[model samples]
Target: MKIEHLTVQGCNEWNEDALILNERERIYGVLDGATSLSSAVGVETGGYLASRIAKEVFETSELPAGCAPLRSLVLMANERIRTAMLERGVDVNDKNALWAAGIVVVRIGEHQIEYAQTGDCMLVAVYKDGTVRTVTHDQVDHFDEKSRLLWERYSKEGLPPDEVRSRVYETIKQNRLKTNTSEGYAILNGEPELEHYVEHGGLNRIQLSSLLVLTDGLFLPRKSGEPTPSMSDMVALIDEKGLSGYVDWLIANEYDESQQGKYTRLKVADDKTAIRIYFE
Candidate 1:
């Protein structure tokens, strides 16, 4: 098997996205959200601090179960962000306000994959038979009439992104503040919906070209009228074009002149990232 990854600033002032692929350990992660606008770490960017510390913890830690590992990583990340905020003189009360949402993938064996995520960064899985599916569910607020009505109301008062997210999950008594809606719900409410399978299994027969991990920047719900590609779409694309064609398509589709600088403007261009894994 072979793994390839690329990270780009995507017209932002600072690279807020972070990704890691530890083939030796069979783990991969992509963190797209930022704690602040200026940096990934240090006094200026607590968000950076959060992501770096989380990545380090994940790289070093071993989990008897993938969910346990991911849960620990998120907690540690929150603490790291808290520490950085204190050192930078940010009020302790504000620490909880800074949250880092991401998707984590852990390969349990040559044949199995375990994943946990919050927010929009995604994991698209492709089987050997050219069948594809998304392991991670989208966490965006639905743009239905009710949601649109709420968005319009909130847009006037100007709620922070985190606040807006919490509001969307308001029916759930505890989806408050900077917590990750998916993971948090699992912890406070119930177990994560684990999707398990034997290593390769059916996939062992077909040639697996890639499993692309992308941040919300490459495909934002509000900005792009185009529907986000379904998992089936990804599988079909890989089957036909393979990695080279997919990469070419991604680069062409994502590098829009009009979209440039949107991230810095907080237009939520987010951050762009791609991880291509090939089964040899």
Candidate 2:
């Protein structure tokens, strides 16, 4: 088995994303600290702090004899994050104040691959037969798509990027109420019910070529109407471009004038993180 990973700072001053590559424990994945909605507390951004807390949990949590390691670790991580907020005198009940993250973790075993996820980080499985399936869905896309449309509409009206963001700010705020609720997506926000919404499963080890675990930042960005490339398209891209090369390609896409227009992206870039595991 071989593992490769890449992480780059986006527009943020510091990278909010982190990777889990505990080879001794056979646990690996990606974590996207949910971008903080509020100002930083001291030098640490909420998103970055949340992600780091989770990273600590995965790195040091003991696996109990009767517990499911990945699932338990994720839940524990959430609790710790929430605890951190509480210690900081944060109003944990306020969605706006909650530090959060999206995580995709897999524990590779000799005969099977165990995985768990929440929020938007994803996992993709590539087979030996030239096929691929996105094992984890981008839970935040449905709401984001609405924001994207609004952003595009405002941009078409010749609004500046700042104006467009202002126009969509309320919608984005309203979407926060839905987080971890029935109408919204799951995230490790230290909410107790988070475990109910976590995505977990196992895959057979045989004939599996690789597992691509990444954050949404690693997704190939598209214009308003351009179809999101399929799982096969993405894996094939990584094959051709390689991990670092793929990130460069994404950066280039963001800068490509031909791709910019009525539906401009909300941000210039995001903290990109990814881990690819190849089965040899």
Candidate 3:
């Protein structure tokens, strides 16, 4: 197996995304720290800490050599985050102090591939037949469509980026009220019970030739009438430019201000992390 990965911070002051690629163990993960909550807290961002903790747990723990390790891994990671909060005098019960994140984990076995995901992180399996299937879906996308539309409107009106960011932050904060609850999306927020919400599955090793795991940061812009890039397009770009170059293409081609009206999103640039694994 060959694994290539990259984590790039957004245009923000700090990059909050974290990742782990253990080719030897055949375990891979990507974590996206929620920016709104992290910005509100005075200390280190919860998303950053939570992701680091999760990566460390996955790296150091004596995980069982099976598909079931995903659940136990998440549970242990949550426990570690809880203990860290208590030790730091952080109020674990306070939502503001809680580190929250969307996480995806993939473990490649000799004959199969196992995956588990919570929140919006995604996993795309590229089969040998040149077909692509998304294993995980975004949880937050549908939660605040109205707010995103309003932000787009504001952007079209020539609002400053900072003002637009503030508005979106408020919207994200409000939407987070549903996090971990029945009404909201599930995330790794030091709550072990939320593990049940994890979406997981397996694929036959013979069926998949490669895997791409990504945080929500990487997306194709929809130009008025132009078709959004398909999975094959994305894979082709990666094949031609590699992961870092692919992200550079996104920033140059899609995230520019001149492209605003044609390509609008909640955030202009987001921390992008991706892992590409090839079974050779």
Which candidate number maximizes lDDT?
Answer: 2
Model 2 clash pairs are none
Angstrom error of the Cα, residue 241, model 1: value is 6.1
Worst 10 residues of 2 by lDDT: 59-68
TM-score per model over all chains: 0.62, 0.94, 0.87
Task: Write the number of the candidate with greater TM-score, choosing between 1 and 2.
Answer: 2
Per-candidate Cα lDDT values, in order, are 0.50, 0.85, 0.77
Would you list the rank order by TM-score, best first? 2, 3, 1
Candidate 2, number of clashes: 0
Show pairs that collide, candidate 1. Answer: 35-47, 40-48, 111-199, 128-203
Report the C-alpha lDDT of model 3 over 206-268, residue by residue, as the tens digit: 767889998888765555445546666777788788888999998886556678767546666
Candidate 3's C-alpha lDDT?
Answer: 0.77
Candidate 2 vs candidate 3: which has greater TM-score? 2
Angstrom error of the Cα, residue 260, model 2: value is: 3.5
Ordered by lDDT, highest first, the candidates read: 2, 3, 1
